[model samples]
Target: MGEQHGCQTCHGDTDAHVADPTMKNVLVYQAKGGSAVDELSAKCLACHDSDTHMAMWKMSKHSRNDISCFNCHTMHATRGAVDQPTKCFTCHRDIKVAVNKQSHHPIIENKIKCSDCHNTHGTATQHMIKDDTVNQLCYQCHAEKRGPFVWEHSPVEENCLICHSPHGSRHAKLLVEKVPNVCQDCHDWSRHPGTPYDANAGFTGSSPSNRFFARSCLNCHGAIHGSANFENHGLRQ
Candidate 1:
């Protein structure tokens, strides 16, 4: 049967298994005590090396970590392509939690797949991202943010991770921290650093000058990402 299907090409020397009909005689790619990861991966690469996506597998982080094809892929499985995330979530438990967060990409909704951002097989970019840079990868979907505005937020242009969390966050808009706190990371807050301005502060109308009244810094700096209008240098418009 191995020869009929050319399984031996990958399983290797299944002649002993054909003679003995036992697991011990067969080369199980993912068996706990069987061949080393390199030996197992070599079998997979032999057939997959020609694939454009898999071309970089040899240089991927997964390859360097001794992860084999069997680690993520299950041969002869009847599972659909959408089911792939379930296998990934098994190891990426942290990302599982992040995707479940209230504010997150539409991963759980199945509107998007992990492969949208990542080239799991391999990539020259860090984190196996499909694009050369994170911002470029994001621009694939958010073309609006791919702007050459007159006023630019330096960090927004440099790296999205500076203010936002790629996976998920408790804060709205996937912000790494809450509004004022996120802004305070770069802006100096010596004037009203730790002042507690809640609904009471606005209800009383006593501290209208406080920066923490409503949306905080965003109240004035509305165009936080960038602005097309030249007059909006403070990002207010």
Candidate 2:
């Protein structure tokens, strides 16, 4: 915040970054490079710890998890030399895998950023999410799903994560699981006698094969996310 100068101000004794300034005493954040995570972040925080957004740094998830400023921000590079996405993926490989699946947010395409839905700096919400709840964050992009509908799906009314995977999914709609399986999580309790929705019980066997194919649940319950209808049993758009 004040007049700051020289690499030594942040790096603190350039020789320390070097294992020996001559040999192997220097520490590395990676298998071989730079310094320790705590040292680096502490140095940065010594200068920046007073900032408004950084007020919660002491209690932040990243701080507690040993994440340093360099984890997301690079020093001594051109303005945009580093890619935040790749840096983020380094720690969150699980999310990296999820986003690469068939259906996902447009993060890889650069239409979205990890920071778009997450503060990453600090937040009161779990996962450092920017909103009070997952559904609230999702409603920023999917306002249609935030309906005060005439009929509400129980899980949908509760949490979007119950039916959807926010990162990505192999399923067509970022669904947590496949369609009927997603529906079956709730609807499997009740069924008629001698007429099951399994692989062998529909219209002379042809019905089961065709009707219960991929996303058969959606074919009937087209408005699965939610529907505003007062008729048709409230499962329509």
Candidate 3:
């Protein structure tokens, strides 16, 4: 029906992605599935591969396991970076348990994702790091703890993982264990706050000892480092 009246069907505007500078290299559509693994490799190598830091993934455990970009990332889903954890949980069921443990990062309630802490794409450092060290990675959120304080807690600086679980924990404040005992592990009576102890006042099955050993160190040092305000009796306010 050449030049037919009321004919509405028509071709769209000319494709400009290839010709437009701003549109150059913009992803239009992504392939799917293992059948397209070669295509996926080629597509990824266009930006990644030997020339980039991400080339390490060519021989990584994930690569050996056949974990690819599309396996964890969706090109155009309602779930983006903010929901990446849920996407990861689709395969890693243990992550669900980890994120739900008693003391977890605010990921679930805040809708933050695993990618927020762990960089999956690429980085200049190992582990596809967004930061140089584990503490630095944690400091991205716990900036208050990254202090050059007058009194530095060794464990606090050495490895937070020792006392905290990055995924989660069963104890309050993300503690690795119940207190008094947990503190006693390193702070025995001999090293009472890091000093020699007197046998005369040695820790025995006394009333005072029971009082002191009944609860976690946090029961009294609730504020811990945050406890700067002390009462007249030298107790945390």
Candidate 4:
């Protein structure tokens, strides 16, 4: 309540509030506070300067879309951090459903937060990803996939999304689709028999083939991500 105190950090110019207890004289960030989005954000930006994680906030998707800081944060709220997946999922309903899928990144388990890979404050990337590229972000955890292999998978090097879904997947290992099928997306595999093709296929192979006999494509091609081994050009290492 004092000038030297930190109350003024957010409740800007509390003199009027002190004078009139009933007056909505102080700056409030909520809708009933009658403060504009820009005005409310300006108050936060005044302290959260654009130097740290808040850098490039003006270029952020949330900023461009008129999202306010209070939308995700309530510093004086009831209990512990309410801005976890609970707050994020409120707006991102689709991702909420995705995270509950068979294969996910342990978000529901509370092992990770959305901020682990995303910068809600601001970012230069499309999805507000913490890193410059999707592959770079995935490399944070899947470091083995980040290799300077002699036989580099073009899709793996280009984007991890091509074969995997970051949020979740019905397929194991967060794969976008079942094996051999995911491979057939580019390999154009029609030579061998017993192909239990994807949804579009008319003939679903009944007999077990080399591709689906054991662990599917992983049976022979384990290092499908990339291969440093000159011994196996097919990346079977």
User: What TM-score does each of the candidates earn?
Assistant: 0.83, 0.77, 0.62, 0.79
Ten contiguous residues with the weakest lDDT in model 3: 5-14
Q: Of the pair 1 and 3, which is ahead by TM-score?
A: 1
Clashing residue pairs for model 2: 19-26, 20-23
lDDT of 2 by residue, 1-237 (tens): 669687667655666645555644433434236567777777777777666457667688988987778767766667667666787899899999999999998999989989988887788888888889998999999999888877677788789999899899999789888867777777663541113365544345245444534335555567765677856444444
- Model 1 Cα lDDT, one tens digit per residue, 48-161: 666754678879998898888888877667658537668789879999999888789888888888888998888999999999899999888888887888888888899998
lDDT scores in order: 0.77, 0.73, 0.59, 0.79
Per-residue lDDT of candidate 4, residues 74-164 (tens digit): 8577755674899999889999999999999999999999999999888878798999999999999999899888888789989999999
Better of 1 and 4 by lDDT: 4
- Clash pairs (backbone) in predicted model 3: none
**Judged by TM-score, which candidate is best?**
1
Instruction: Identify the candidate with maximal lDDT.
Output: 4
TM-score of model 2 vs. true structure: 0.77
Number of clashing pairs per prediction, in order: 0, 2, 0, 0
Error of 1 at 33 (Å): 4.8
TM-score of 4: 0.79
Question: Where does candidate 1 have its weakest 10-residue lDDT segment?
Answer: 205-214
Better of 1 and 2 by lDDT: 1
Cα deviation of 220, candidate 2, in Å: 2.5
Worst 10 residues of 2 by lDDT: 189-198
